[model samples]
Target: MAEMSYRTALVTGATSGLGRGLALWLARRGLRVFAAGRRVSQLQALAAEAQAAGATVEPVELDVTATDATLERIRALDGECGGLDLVVANAGVGGVTHAKRLQWERVKAIIDTNVTGAAATLSAVLPQMVERRRGHVVGVSSLAAFRGLAGHGAYSASKAFLATFMESLRVDLSGTGVRVTCIYPGFVKSELTEKNNFPMPFLMETEAAVDRMGNGILRGEGELYFPWQLALPSRLLKVVPNPLFDAAARRFR
Candidate 1:
């Protein structure tokens, strides 16, 4: 186990995928981890697995979409833990929302979970962190935030919103000892990505992707984009002419 600056951490969306992987990784590194998710079964499994590995991981049943409840639960958890050294707002939902056949329900879920839920998770911890002048907050965004993909309009937009939100927070909190990191990841194997029927380039396994993100969070990077293969092109797409970018994005449709 590597020496860590953080002694206690909370990871939202910890029932599966990157969130689960990150929670376990942090525990293994000697941090007391609070894994929050909606699935009781999965949370129990996570706690058991961590215990077997001789790590501390507590499961907290939370639905980030329930703003009031989420805020209350996390604040109480933070107080119980004495203070959260790190908080990862990794709870997010993804789906293909074609512009022509857009479903309001799907788009709303993406917004509620990815935007509202993530914001609530951070808000719940930030006040104390600010008062104490010590903490790290991470936001899991996506490379798709660089451009609005043809078939993933809403999902891409939500990520973009998160990235911008994190960036703003970083600037606002500078010199305050609160570190803000926004991670833009490419495709990683997860429940959310498994539903994609179209091709996913530069697909990454959950463990490897989470490892990279974990390192970045600990290093206190302001913005981390992984799998250079995809990150390079995605960064370029941000400046590509709209006419050219649209032509290429159409292939996903």
Candidate 2:
């Protein structure tokens, strides 16, 4: 693990849940934080709290889904913070849908926010990071990426893309100072998860998820899996044969 201190960190989806938790934790560590999200009120509250702790908290009232707006916010931040040391793309959504009867609208929204938005955000910042040859790109993917999941095809597939993308990035930047880490967290109790009707085997609190992510990032882990148990099982299901996976998932049904 490199023991370098970061002066600035940009966290997306920072209004509530895991994103908010990560922003707070980073701020308390004395890093200037640029929190981006659509919720102005909650961003304000987070800014105020983070400011009280001696961290320069700039709450960006920006929509990442808007390409121009995302670029503008990031460009302004480059000047405000001089340069970004770490970027965390944590925006995502969850909904249930079957392959045969997928909710195309929800799937579209998920692809837009989770995949396209992340790629756009990375595009906005990576050029500078590459120019400086110093930075970290951490994404909040999910263990769902390991499997197709029962009724959450869109969510799982989107996360799978992130997992693969980040891993490839890590390899591509091996010699460079820039590092890419993908976070595959298990069930966490948060707004994104409160709507789930099924039981989450190893559900953790947002703070726990925050700690897990931070530790993973600090350790320079190429990929992260929280609570440990949910990590390989999800991956193993895919390896075990389609018939076995179909049988296992039947329990959820």
Candidate 3:
């Protein structure tokens, strides 16, 4: 494995799924990791599991939806760590909704966490990274962002928002020495994916997915899309004719 470019890191949504996997993986690689999540018990469990494996992971209780508090906590963590070398805005929520019977509450929850919360996580540490002229900011988007899917309109839109938001950051911070990476992952086993009732092509195990993600981050890739079997098709969806795409998407609904 290539040596990680960072020594200190923070991962939000660290209680479960991809966030949890990445947090432990980075710690095992010898980085000082701060794992932040809303669930205290899960956070403690993560810390204990890491410790048992002789890795360092500090658990932090954080609710990313509380934008003000989220910003303050991240800023404090940066100072406590003497400055965070990397921040992974991995916190997000997913939901399935349909246009005909859309529930505002479900849609709102997805936006609140996946968009607003993730944005706050990055925005909190961005200034310090810019001042130091060295740091990596990673956003965990989804292949779903490539095109809006049936029964996943809200979730797809949220990931699309994050992907574009990070892209803009990458362009704006071109020469500031701060690296920005946006990850677009296909279906992977997680609390989120377990709820899917439809078939998921090329579903990846969480560990395998995180390994690819971690390596890409270490290499400072601007954008990382994984499990090419699915990524290729998902990318192609961008150029698919609207009529054909709509016809195919309706089957999933």
Candidate 4:
């Protein structure tokens, strides 16, 4: 794969974790970055940190769940930046509740943010990428997408949707000079994973995870899964018989 050079980028969920890490990493690579998230203070803090590092980062308060507003902000940012070389759809939420305890509102929120919001993010940026004939789109999925965990049905299903969506999109954009990458990360230290009660095998630090993902994205890899220790098992689980898989996965619940 040829080395990909980026001049400008936007990363959603930039307040913390992988998104924040990617935003800073890209900015440090000499890309002007738009760090987007729901929290103004956190975004500002990220921008300040980037500036202190001699990088350019602009904080953009955005809620990916708000589709129209998010699109408007992206368009405005694109106009301001001349064009975007990359867009990372990384905002996500998850819950550890059992199906019986999973409220309707919670399910809706997960689907809306993870599925609908991701689609909206792509919809807003892809047209511009196609027009420019140069851009990369990164979808931050999860290993959970390979199978639906007992207590993480909504979250897993959402990631499944995203992985499939990005795959389909990659085909749709073939020969368009627009790269699409879907990343299925295993357990990584982050605000989201901090809530998990079960033992997380092959857990990686946020910085290491970001580095791996960044490298994959730069290479324009169609799909990426890290820490082979966890990724191999997740892929194996995809082929296991449902009954056996359920029995094994239930232990995690």
The C-alpha TM-scores of every prediction are 0.97, 0.95, 0.97, 0.97
Task: Give the higher-lDDT candidate: 1 or 4.
Answer: 1
CA displacement after TM-score superposition, residue 246 of candidate 4 (Å): 1.7
Q: Candidate 4: which stretches are off by over 4 Å?
A: 1-3
The digit string of per-residue lDDT tens for model 1 on 15-68 reads 999999999999999999999999989999999999999999999999999999
RMSD list, candidates in order:
2.1, 1.4, 1.8, 1.1
- Sort by lDDT, best first: what order? 3, 1, 4, 2
Comparing 2 with 4 on lDDT, the higher-scoring candidate is: 4
**Model 1 spans with C-alpha error above 4 angstroms:** 1-4
lDDT of 3 at 206: 99
Candidate 3 structure lDDT = 0.94
lDDT of 3 by residue, 91-159 (tens): 988877889889999999999999999999999999999999899999999999999999889999999
lDDT of 2 by residue, 135-241 (tens): 88898899899888888988998999888888888888887788899998899989989999988898898888898888778777888887788876876776788
Error of 4 at 138 (Å): 0.6
Please estimate how well model 2 matches the true structure, expressed as its whole-model Cα lDDT.
0.85
Please report, as a residue range, the 10-residue window in candidate 4 with the lowest summed lDDT: 1-10
